[model samples]
Each structure stands twice: as C-alpha cells, then as structure tokens.
Target: DTAVSQTPKYLVTQMGNDKSIKCEQNLGHDTMYWYKQDSKKFLKIMFSYNNKELIINETVPNRFSPKSPDKAHLNLHINSLELGDSAVYFCASSQDPSGRPPYNEQFFGPGTRLTVL
Candidate 1:
C-alpha cells in the first residue's frame, strides 16, 4: 500500500492552461508538503500544510495554489501555466514536527511530471 499517492503521474498541456494534481496520504500524518523539482533537479518546497492549516508558503507565484481539505489530502492547482512550469512535483507527508520526535522523515509519493509547451 502506497503511503502517499498523487494522480495524473504524467501531465502534458499547453501554456496558459490550468491543471491540478491531487495527493493523498494514508499514513495518518498531520503534515504534508508540495515540492517542485526543476529540470536541473533542484527540489524546492512550494507549500506546506499542517493539520489542514497552511503553515508554510514559499516564494511561489500566485498562479500556483495549494489546498488542503483535510490532513490526509493536499492538492495543487496551477493556473495560467507557463513553459517554466514544466517539472516534477512531489507530495510528501510526515508526522507533525511538534510531536515527540522533533523531526520526522518525510514519506514521498511518486512524482507527477508536468510538461508545458
């Protein structure tokens, strides 16, 4: 059983198009994050959610939005996508850092590759 899963593993679309990637975690984690890996393979955190509340928002553009309807799910919606948006997006989950462990290793999902032309 996959601990974390993302839909539309491969997405190809034209510029200005809107797309969404859905993510879910069954590990019963309270924290989830969205990371983007560019063609250069530089992974950067885009957003983070803890217990259904937005905890971290990086320097991502307003065109990109992340929604967490519940602690188990985190979704990314991109509007007016551009060529620069082409990259691999990853969804990860981990126990809340405030807990006993102080730090928990994140469980990553199979990345979703988005290509904008």
Candidate 2:
C-alpha cells in the first residue's frame, strides 16, 4: 500500500485559474506537509499540519493555501495561478514531533505536476 498518495499527477492550465490537489496518507502519521519543487528542482515547504493544525511556512505566498480535514489528509489550493506557479507539488507525512524518539524522516508521495500557461 502507498504510504502517501496525490491525485491528478499532471495539471495543465491557463493563467488566473484556480486549482486544488488532494493528498492522503495511510501511515497514520500526525504531521503532513505540502512542498513545491520549482523549475530549478529546489524543494520548498509550503505548509505543514500537525494534528490538523496549520503551520504555515513564512516563505510561501498568500496565493497558496493548505487544508487538512484530518491527520491523514492535506490538500493544497492555489488561486489566480500564475506562470510562476508551474512546478511539481509533493505531499509528505512524518511522525509527530513527540512521537519521534529517534528521528522521523518525511515520506513523500508521487508529485503532481502543475503547468500554467
């Protein structure tokens, strides 16, 4: 079974559109995150949710928002998508900080490729 999964593995859209990507994790992890990989292949954290609480990454733009219905799911929503938004988005999960006696590595899903024209 996949530990983490994301829908719509590829998306192509025009500028100024809105889109959302859904993600689910079956690892029973408490912390879930959304990350963006730009054209340069640099991965940046966009949002993190631990037990359904939001933990925004200050570097992320206001245009991007993340919602988690439960500890097992976190979805990313982007509004007024710009060409700069063209990138791959990854969903990940890790054990809650308190549960990490050792170290917990983040497990990433197959990314969703978003292209804005």
Candidate 3:
C-alpha cells in the first residue's frame, strides 16, 4: 500500500470555480504538508499541520486553505480558483522534526495535477 495517497490524480476546472483535493497518510507520521509545484517545477510549502494543529502557514493567498481533521489527513481547498492556481499539488508527511536525530525526510504522494482554464 502507498504510504501516502491523494484522490483525483488530475483536476480540471474553470476560473472562479472552487475545488478540493484530499490527502491521507498511513505512515503514522505526526506532521503533514501541502506543497505546490509551479510550471517551472519550483516546489513551495503552502501549509504544515502537526498533531492536529497548524504550525506552518506560508504567505499564500486567502483563497487557498489547508484543513487537517487528524494527524493522518490533510486536505487542500481552493476557493475562486484563478489561472495561477494551475499546478501540481503534492501531499507529504514526515515524522515530527523535534525528535532526536531531527527527521527531515518527507514521503510524498502521487501528486494531483490541477489545470485551470
């Protein structure tokens, strides 16, 4: 089984539409993250949730929101999607970095490619 997985591997939508991507991890990691990869393939961390609390929130537009109901799931919702929202959204999970050895590795799921027209 995949350690991390995402639904709707591809998403196509129009401008001004709202869409959501679901993600889940079964590795028992305490931290999950949402990342966006631009057309140039530059990946940026959009949100990070650890132990049911949000610990890192980048300067993303208000239109994008990350919700975590528990430690194993982190969902991304985009409201009034814009053309710039077209990108590959990735879900990743990692063990708490505060541990002894400071685990810095993240396991990524098969990304969801979002296209906006």
TM-score of each: 0.95, 0.93, 0.95
Q: In model 1, which regions exceed 4 Å deviation? A: 99-102
| Model 1 C-alpha lDDT per residue in residues 49-110, reported as the tens digit of each score | 99999988999999999999999999999999999999999999999845356557889999
Q: Which lDDT tens digits does candidate 2 get at residues 47-68?
A: 8899999865658878998889
Q: Which stretches of candidate 2 lie over 4 Å from their true place?
A: 98-101
Q: Write the per-residue lDDT of candidate 3 for residues 1-117, one digit (tens) a residue.
A: 999999889999999999999999999999999999999999999999999799999999999989999899999999999999999999999998453566778999999999999
Q: Residue 101 of model 2: what lDDT?
A: 58
> Candidates 2 and 3: which is better by lDDT?
3
Quantify how close model 2 is to the true structure by its C-alpha RMSD in Å: 1.6
- Shift in Å, residue 47, candidate 3: 0.4
User: Clashes in candidate 3: how many?
Assistant: 0
| Cα-based lDDT at residue 96, candidate 2 | 75
Each model's RMSD to truth, in Å?
1.4, 1.6, 1.3
Clashing pairs in 3: none
What TM-score quantifies how close candidate 2 is to the native fold? 0.93
Measured on C-alpha atoms, candidate 1 has an lDDT of: 0.95
Candidate ordering by lDDT (highest first): 1, 3, 2
* Clashing pairs in model 2, backbone N/Cα/C closer than 3 A: none
Candidate topping lDDT: 1
